[model samples]
Target: MQQLLVVGDIHGFPETFVELLDVGSFEQRVLQLADLSGRPGLRGDNLHDHLVKKDGLQHAVRALRETNGPPCFGIGFSSGGTALWSAVKEGLEIQALICVSSTRLRFETSPLNIPTIVFWGDLDPHRPTEIWNDAVPECCKTYAGKHHDFYRVDALAPNSPLRTDIGAFIESVSGLHSGGPAPAR
Candidate 1:
């Protein structure tokens, strides 16, 4: 059985992601990255560049249960997706990464140990596909609409087409166990 650990944006959207996971039948074995926010959505005085480098994730690395075994896959949605990429880059033992409507951080330059799948919305202000392409080796899944179209938070809006290919993408990327590190000069 493949265990998918779905991570949502650190800013806001943990509940939305959790609801989606439940609807997707992913109730067990999913991990949500917590926010260190003293007040919800309040980022405080931290520098913008270091925003995603959360102490919560760092602690997760230390407190993770080695007994449950490695997750078969990791799904990073929005900002959490990038965090997952960073965690993998920092040597976390994950099999693969699936990033949706997200960008790659500057530190994510080298080719990763596992394959990755990136989902991008054409109008997703974030311009996910463009960022991921420049930094990571991922199969890009582009939607004809915006970022929120891919998300099923409250409900799938009429304009948002059903994503029939995500499961397939996950299957494909998961099968690719090894890939070369990003090219070095």
Candidate 2:
């Protein structure tokens, strides 16, 4: 089976986020990347500072490239998405990308050629602006809540529309439900 790379937000993958995704089903086939130091519980501005202001993003890209050498499907949350994006630009092999609430992408002028999708809440003030959306309107999806809704258990119940959509995307890209061989990485 093809592996999936999951990158967590600055807060890391909270229990709620993990539970909502029922990640255990594919736990063995998933490679999860988080804080640059592999430390837990880093949040808010401090984590942002470490990741962006301190060259941690480059470190993360390097770590990602070293940890997962083959092309694969990826899901990145917030700043983690930015890291994944950078890694891809810097030659990390990734077939597809799903970025949720990666607001910092607003500054990205270059487009990624791989199959990619971005999700953010309608109320997220920091979401990419019209220009960014215009660059890839079809790849952008908006939910009804605010930023971080994807990390909230209550906001993303297993049966919720957002969860269902995300599951479908994963299945489509990974061919998990097709009974056929997944595409070559």
lDDT score, candidate 2, position 90: 84
* Per-residue accuracy of model 2 over 149-173 as CA lDDT, tens digit each: 4544532566765555566666666
* Position 58, candidate 2: lDDT: 73
Candidate 1 residues 17-51, lDDT tens each? 33232123333344444442222333323412234
Candidate topping lDDT: 2
Worst 10 residues of 1 by lDDT: 176-185
Runs off by more than 4 Å, candidate 1: 11-27, 35-68, 104-107, 128-135, 153-163, 173-185
The lDDT per prediction is 0.51, 0.65
Angstrom error at residue 14, model 2: 3.6
